[model samples]
Target: MTFVIQLMSGLAVGCIYGLVAIGFSMIYRAMGLVNFAQADIMMIGAFLGYAILVAAPGIPFWLAIIGAMLGAALLGFVIERVAIRPSVARRADQVYLVLLTLGIGIVLSNGARLIWGADPVVYPTGLTHQTLTLAGYPLPAVYLYIAVVMPALLVGLHLFFTRTWLGLALRAAADDPDTAATMGVRPALATSVSFALASAIGAAAGVLYAPISYVSFDMGVIGVKAFAAAVVGTLGSIPGAVLGGFIIGLGETFGGQLIATEYQDSIAFAIMIGILLLKPTGLLSGARR
Candidate 1:
């Protein structure tokens, strides 16, 4: 029963990592660069949602989530236009772009600290103060919300990629920008759209996770674990991201259950390393199509 409870808890948190991994995968697919600030952007979303909850007490939680998503998406677009695109235009070294993202992460983290203070803030989950019982064990209702939200979001993303023209174009641009340009797919627009989508998804993850864990400026460190999940599942594969997330979640929980809590976090890295040694391209080989 305890194992089950821990597993459920891990799954709920893992879903957040998977969502962030999706952003990492999408941005990497389109731009060939990781937004080191991806996690910080999620922190921004948490604050935005918290602000909405405080400023407009009557506003629905769902509506506040939308506001956070929009804010994060706009921030992503601005970053792409102002920082990434200009550097790309100048044919800057990849190291410079990577450094730029790292710098942006620092700026955003410190800026958040300045505004919110260097303290963790508890978010009001608004979930019922109730627990569902299974096998004589109780689980928080918020777990159900995370479980439901993750699948729904993934399905929406799959539909966007497989059914929509713009989605297909974005995929094409990611696969081959020069070829996509000749085929009338605008690489610049696709890049901007990818960043926006990634940021929105990251924000959604933040809102979902903030309820489970306290929101703090330094919480973006989870982005590293999510990146491990991304690499474990296959960096550019959407389905892989989902698989990798659950694997990491389950592994950490199970490892902690059998071993020690102090080493729980290291389990994800061990799995990542073991998997990478066996499959360099990731467990899933093909990129998202």
Candidate 2:
């Protein structure tokens, strides 16, 4: 029962990682460039939700998340249009693109620090202060909520990609921009939408995460784990990202519990290194560019 409880908690955290990783996958799929700012955008989303909740104490938690998603989406769109597009247009080197994103991430993290200060902010969890018991152990409702929510979101996304016109276009664009453009899809618009989607999804992860963890300007460091998940699961693969997230999350929790808590972060990095050494393309990369 204790093991089960810990697993549940780890899975809840994994859900957040998976959500953020999806954002990474989306942008990489569309633009073939990793957005270093992905995690910072998530941090921005968490702060946005916190701000909304603070301003209107009566607002629903879900509503606050929605607001954060919208705000992050807009931010993503603007950044793509103003910063990324210009770089692509100039035919800059891949290294330059990487540096550009890294700079954007630094600016965002510092800007957030300037606004919210460096302290961690507490976030509200709408769940009751009660725990549900199964066998001899108790589990928080937050864990159950997250488990359900994450899978549901993933399913919805899968359906959207398989069933919707825009989603198909996005997929087509990601698979091959030239072919997609020849099919009358607007590559620029699709790429912008993909960035917006990635930002919104990342922000949603932040919203979910803020409830369980402290929100801080420096919280963007968690992105390191999420990015590792993306690589381990295979960049540009949604399902792969999700699987990588669960693996990392579970490994961290189990390692902390059975080994040393102080080395929890190291556990994830080790797993990433192991996976890369074993399979450079990742567990689920399979033919994806």
Lowest summed lDDT window (length 10), candidate 1? 122-131
Against the reference, the lDDT scores of all candidates come to 0.85, 0.87
Error of 2 at 149 (Å): 2.3
Clashes of 2: 0
lDDT of 1 by residue, 1-289 (tens): 7867887888887898889888888898898897788888888888888888778876776787789999999999999999999999999998999899889888888988988889898765455345788678898766776777788888999899889999999988988999999999988988899889999999988888887777798888988888888889998777787778888878887887789978878998998999999999988886533
- How does candidate 1 fare on TM-score? 0.95
Which digits, one per residue and each the tens of the lDDT, describe model 2 over residues 1-289? 6689788878877878888899999899898999999999999999998899888887877788789999999999999999999999899988999899889999999999999998888865455354777566787655665766687778888888899999999989988899999999998987799889999989988888886778899888899999998999999899989998998899898988999988889998899999999999899977543
Model 1, runs deviating above 4 Å: 128-130, 134-136, 286-288
Extract clashing residue pairs from model 1: none
